[model samples]
Target: MTLMASDTSADVVIVGTGVVGCLVAERALDAGLSVLMLEAGPRVDRWRIVENYRNLPPSMRLFHWDAPYPPKPWAPHLETRVAKESEQYLQLEGPNARAYLQGYVRYAGGATWHWAGICWRLTPEDMRLKSLYGVGRDWPFGHDVLEPYYTAAEYAIGVCGPSDPALQWPPNAERSKPYPMGPIPFGPGEKRLTEAAARIGMMNLPAPQARNSGVSYHGRPPCCGNNNCFPVCPIAAKYDAATALPKIEAKGGKILANAVVYRVETGEKNAVEAVHYFDPNKVSHRVTAKLFVIACNGIETPKLLLLSKDDRNPNGVANSSDQVGRNMMDQPKLFAEVELAEPLWTGVGPVQSSSILNTTQGEFRNRYAGAMFRMENFARSPLGSAAALKKGLVGKALDTEIRRLSACTARLTVEHEPLPLPINRLTLSSKTDWLGINKPNIYYDVSDYVRRSAKEYTVPRLQQLASELGATSFQLSPEFLNSDHIMGGCIMGSEAATAVVDADCRAHDHQNLFLPGGGAMPSGTASNSTLTMAALALKAADAITAQLKHG
Candidate 1:
């Protein structure tokens, strides 16, 4: 990517260089508009990240996945695993504090660098939660409205899904076009779970993923089952936003890293006049643009908006509705660690390849939350080695113990869909970062809807799976955990008084400013939300292009 210049004027200034902003920048540049993207974090090389992860300390490698990319002094993300209040960049408190301990990083690519590559699209029922299930807010439009954009996002991101429509996530995804590549074959462990789940009347389908299966697409190679997709991908097979930066720059889009945007300057009629940011050295810089889009994830996006307040907009930039940071949501999750009678042998493919999706949608949503389950495919060598070393085992004995433990152990996860609660809010913390900006303070609770499902619907189903898998030892986590699929905070709706953004993700308070991605999602189903976020980004790009061309 080209260097950032002193001249920062552009037609559009996007506040985060994650996939959302990168896609928006690409579309605006394609429309011949001058695009400038300001990223809070520093630009990093992919190879460098891979090497850093490879050489990290054993403890850090096992526990601290974000250790590879240390946070910049100004662009700090939630770093410390410790629950100490003083050490947190994102101050989380509620009935479920552990549930909100997110693992996102402040790097050039955003969180996708450490993702499992799963890409599940939302079903029609997922969008119309209020109308169909009598609970939660519904999307402004239906699945038919988002179908084309979903197709476009899948092709742009090079998604691979099952060839058989019956095996698709939405029971034959309503696709205008087929997947770019067929599904990756499941490993022995995945196949075993698929078969067992089927006998129990559950459909465990192959997951639609972004990484390639056997052929190359858009210059990236196919996955070779490296099984270390958590910290780094090692190779450029999986999709990451960092890979999109150079292409955006090649098309005349300017990206400024280490530029921590703190204020959104508004002028007459609440139009976005400019945005001001502080560099790592704490020197502030301001840039003017005709329009602005804040594509920082759910947490950071709301934090940035709350920081930008003026006499005309006292509550915050888009607080005319007082909804900038309300309605925080996530797919609250639980894990079940099981040991089988015989070796199950996970880690034969990507970190995740299939899931039991039948539970994600049902008529039972009126009572409790719907949940989905998956067996994690992370290689067990590190965990096995740790277990073996603790026993004072040596040499061949150590190797034998590690081998058996890794092969026989498995982790099953239950991710429950959550409702957008007004109480689950993200506000500005009294705590300040190294740049003297207020950190994000979020109060999160999984709520009774999710908890009811865990006790009645999901936990029972998990027990059945463990029984079917012939688990000699079974241990389910006591509390709900964060699936890392953050949503809400800046909710969307038909009324300007209730929602932060409009149907096109444009902020209601400021016509020229758009707030897209996860923060604007009204509902998040029991699946990975990244693909849905990408579809929304492309949709927002269309609106931005239209405004630039005709308005």
Candidate 2:
């Protein structure tokens, strides 16, 4: 399976066969371009797919609370050198230093394989954070420009939700039509919270999701409602990038699995000419193509660019702007749990069914703050829930408390925007991995704005909502203090000095090279990033097609 440098060339070489890469390949094929998609993971076998139920060990499951998790068999060879944990704070150096944060995902479909498909479009204000809120940088393109692309992505991926008429926050764009599928069923906990929020003058509605509730347009079956959406979808109810790879293959694009792209080979003018990768059997291969797209998640994408050092571009490939790996940001999450006076069914549907815009504006807006609270669906397994209950309620009568709290428990999650800081960034370390490439060193710390915003603004609002819902005892989950939604690093902007890609998603230095996914996001909004990432990929695909047609 190892493909060497003498491997066949392609019209377009896509590094990383994730959702974005697959979409890009599909678009390339549509434009009459032959595509070769390189994936570091092995080809997926449907029979080998395991159910992500709570019975499995945390390490095997996604979203587990364990460090030094066992690396997947197909993990990139270059990733072995990544520091496990450093005593001294390691500062990154070099032009692409900012983009070196440690990120995971070596599977063929990437992180989407373990993602919760809570879909929400970035608010219009999100695109112009600097112009409107005087914080963060404005996106080169606004929500208006991405509306059409968003619609296309929605249909392609089969989104489910009703357009909110309230129009708060960034507000969704004018949809070409409604969601391909209907909203997921609201659980009893969501019903109680929704009713309580509405009575207290709060706007609560069914949160838009990418999970299938019924037969979807794409011929995918509805979600089985196993309450396990994070790790793996046993029935493919939730949208994963794997769903799109077949479509790309059907369109004549070739997906080369078990191919780990090590670097982007550039020519005399610093333009990428081919992607250098190693196959499963340690065979080195080079895929020459007219265009190269890097969608290897945020961390690896930047790392690959930095590793592609050449005499012409001494710093790295597409490092002329020195913004390849800067502005690392992850939405820090805060969770608040409330025990309602009346018992409510804890699990009956998707984990998050209803959301409220309690603090989307006002003083929080001026501080570049994110949303305050949303009614999260409690989909934790019995074991995990038992662990949560034990942590929050500590008393002699533990058994009695667990029995009483099982039916009435409810949790709300607050997603706050992390302020992009230069010091908290990614860089290449001296440590070398099996591939002989330096490991990606990540340094991340939540900003004061994020900490203060969650404690001062969000926590209070959540408490007040719980009080209004006639809750007896309210406790916040300590585990939620650190956010899971990771973004930034390789952000898109108008200038090469400030951003990695242009508004069109083309690398500033190399016109034919593109980088998509969370890395391209200028700012991580309150909503889930997968939808936005897919939308941006569609937009980039269109731009690439136009350029190919014109040239």
Candidate 3:
């Protein structure tokens, strides 16, 4: 694994080749800037991951979804499916340690490689949480400023959603453009749940997805109802950052894989001078650029900034305000397992199709955190077998019971939005990894706001929804889990003293450093933050373009 180091300079250099990083690199290249991307993890082929997933036994498929994508020693990521392995990567403490066991992989394509591809947009109400509800902090700008970028991101990612405005989430939110393609029709289980939810005055809307619906999009095939978006998507129907790598290269953007960035070098006027990285062999290399963007994961972004501490930035890069790793946020999740008399016949389409979007906003936010709900559409055959086997049934009785439970069981989910708190923080751990880099130590409390919401508001509503589904028996999961939507580490604000980045995601302390994507999000609305992250990436690119071209 011997590698040579040479001086490489570009107009803009980005760290992390995830969706957000790729989006920025693509835009910078399209704007005729020499763009270079440094990825800590090795490049993996999608087909190989798909084959690995297909080789798994049916019993292990659902449980070990991420087993196919093994972590390389130099580039390790948390695998929550295995608690011990997860703890070794991310040191977690606090009252809700299990909830903070964030599951993400370090690969050139980024976490999008194994994502559900559901893109939930933040509403105007979400941006103005403080003004309207007097609970959480408000965004620096309103939804109107971000709408165009959202639309652009949707088109770039090839998203498909319902054409009818009434069927869209936040039905009243104004849109800058229609969806790129029509939505995928709901399956039998989704249809039945929709009807039941409607009777209870809940609207289940089709979630905008990064997967192609019917016809092929951007040279990618359409989804064929495999219900296997997790782990791997066999065909390129779903939008993964890896799929954009070739296009980026075609546009003259160089991607250096297996190059982990550990430091951000600063120079005169507090501008980013260059970035130093380590190859898999621990060979150090210096990459200089006029401008730099570190689009690493929410956890890794702050960790990198903190790791880059120098004489000038003793607290950390962009930590003059001492908020680089503060305000950690994620959508806290709970589950409800229901047994119904009639078969829901789940797993007809994608792993997730629709969710109760209306519950995400309201006046109730003044008292408790708001929530969003969804019915997981993962194939239930394995769960059914596991459940039926526990009953001690044998022979034909076991087979019959499996069949009944497979079709009759449903898993409903609720994600309660968390307010940003400085206490929910990530710090450099004493523990070190293979590369001797400090592992991330996180302190997360689901917070009394989320606790009260689940206890007083969300739990009762979830039970009410379950009752409407005609459940013969229902059990609610007692513990809170992560939705894997990480946010707020590098929080954005208008003023420099209170926030790490500006609205455009430029680091407040460094003129040439822009930290975009999930880490820069101010508020983690009760939905997937992937779309908003992509939009922020694009918006940051626009700002970078203006600076480089106009100046």
Candidate 4:
């Protein structure tokens, strides 16, 4: 099929309008470079998403964080509400396929639209896992190199975190700058957990979050604690890409929504010359640029590369190493909930406010993966109320049950660091979407390292913590779950033979092409990876800026 004569041109062409892509656009545009961002999903407003959540049937609302933002036919993300329902879109196999059923939105701003806004930085030790622990591969650069970018990202997204150095996570990574604002006040549940954890020799610190704590920064209002952060922040308190698009456009960057990128075209020297995308009408349009960046997360970026095959490079663009969709990693997660003998009143503030930092590091990492534990701050109202009403309780009994569960129930979650394995990967499925693009087929499994960590350390520690909370009944999930922190698809390395991108996030085969974000991450530490992904994006932006200046 003949594509339309180069539909448009720009200094930089970016695929995926997620936080990483949008942040890069902001930096590139600020540096006076014209950028064209193509998003496969529709451009939705905050109000629309909030209304969608409100209109959902009461029963579905609790598990409907990613449901309200339905997938567009052209660009589908994993539908995780139900496995059987989502299988038609994402083909899953292997032992841990169910855990890989992630919850992410394809719309502009991507998954951050429904994220809890937690931000954790990797320690220098995390980057040197192979050198320090003899386990995973080491990053080309260390945490110190990314620290500046982390600081920049925190300010860019208006992160509020602890000012005390002791309270910061991954304690070994020194900070050059304090957070933009002081930490958000911990919820009642977090306070209770912190006290209980201290008695048992655990350290629970306030989590660094991207949402504004008090004073508004970057035009976003402060978080009002509406407790609807997952589906969508009722108000624009959290930093989502939607809040950045207008500013990006104000700086002359253009965004084309509902533009599904299908193929990447390479020219002389195997450099990325252009990309082909399908519009909402299924008409093909070729977009040319001097430089191109694919920040479509772990799955879609590699899928696009595999789809773009040619004689000069038959193994897919930038996949000379055959690592495009390989080494996919996520923090295998477990949840432990208990009915406390006393009311803890968990729904006081943001969804998640604090976590135990003690177990995230140690010499034990050489044998088993590390884990981070946190108290889920979601108010028990919606879930408890719904369950009570379903039990056929009328007025007084219903109110009593709801109050008891909402105030007394406490939850703890353990997120484990999983070692990267080439066998756990993503491929193109035989099934096709409305646009005829083949859906993604993924095979995933949590390594024994993580399983061992849960069995030996995290689970037992969590059970002890729950017991210390004076729980009447406590139970931990039997199986590992996906934490939604996707990483290591287009992994970075020093050698071109083993990695798709280099330390600078530039494709080894295509100098002008970059695949940043979590996809370029070489390691998945036990923490929320959004801040790390943003740091990598900023680091890549600096390299792209320098390349444009010299060339």
- lDDT by residue for model 4 over 1-551, one digit each (tens)? 21211238888889998889988988888777888899889999888988888888876787756778888778777653454664467777898787787778788878878888999888888899999999989999877899999999999888999887888876635787899989899877888899999999899989899999888888999988887778888888999866888888787788888999999999877888899999989999999988999998888898899899899889888999999889989999999878888998888888888888788889999999998888889898887787678899988998999988888897789999988789988888888888999888899989789888988998899989998889898878878888989898899999999999999899999989999999998899998899999999999999998898677
What is each predicted model's overall lDDT from 0 to 1?
A: 0.87, 0.69, 0.89, 0.87
TM-scores of the candidates in the order shown: 0.97, 0.87, 0.97, 0.97
Runs with alpha carbons beyond 4 Å of true place in candidate 4 = 1-7, 80-87
**Candidate 2 lDDT score at position 116:** 69
List, residue by residue over 1-551, the lDDT tens digit for candidate 1: 32232347788899888778888888888888888888899889888888888798898888888888888788888665543667778888999977887878887768868888888888999999999989999999888988888888889888999888899878855679989999899998998899889989888999989898899987889999898877778887888865688888898888888888999999987899999998888888889988899998999998888999899999999889999899988888899999888889898989989988889888999989999899998888788889899999999999999999999999999999999989999999998888899988889888899989998999999989988988998899988888888889888887999899988899988989998898889998899998988899999999999998899
lDDT of 3 by residue, 1-551 (tens): 21122247788999988899989988988888888888888898888888878887876676767778778878888753465653478888898877877878888888879899998888899999889988778999989899999999999999999888888866866888899999999999999989999998888998999999998998899999988889877787999865789988887888888888889998867788989988889888899988999998899999999999999999999989899999899999999999998999999989998999898888989888989998999888889999999999999999999999999999999999989899999999998888889999999999999999999988888889889988998899979998899899999999999999999999999988999998888888899999999999999999999999888
Model 2: per-residue lDDT, tens digit, 1-551?
21222236777778887768877777778778777888877665433445224455653353341112224443542223343544112334443233332334576777666666766777777777788878777888777788777777878777787655453224444666677777777777777777878777777767677778877556567877777555566677777755777887787777777777887887867778888787666678777877778988777788888888788777777777777667776666767667777776666776666677545655466664767477656543453446556577666566556655666666777877765566656678886555566666676666666667767777777788888878898888763343445567778888888778888788888988988878888887666777788888888888887877677
> Residue 143 of candidate 1: its Cα lDDT?
88
For model 1, what is the C-alpha lDDT against the true structure?
0.87
Clashing pairs in 3: none
Total clashes in model 4, counting residue pairs 3 or more apart in sequence or in different chains: 0
Per TM-score, what order, best first? 1, 3, 4, 2
Model 2 sits at a Cα RMSD from the real structure of: 4.8
Q: Lowest summed-lDDT stretch of 10 residues in model 2?
A: 62-71
The root-mean-square deviation over C-alpha atoms between each candidate and the true structure, in angstroms, is 2.0, 4.8, 2.7, 2.9
Between candidates 2 and 4, the TM-score winner: 4
- The best candidate in terms of lDDT: 3
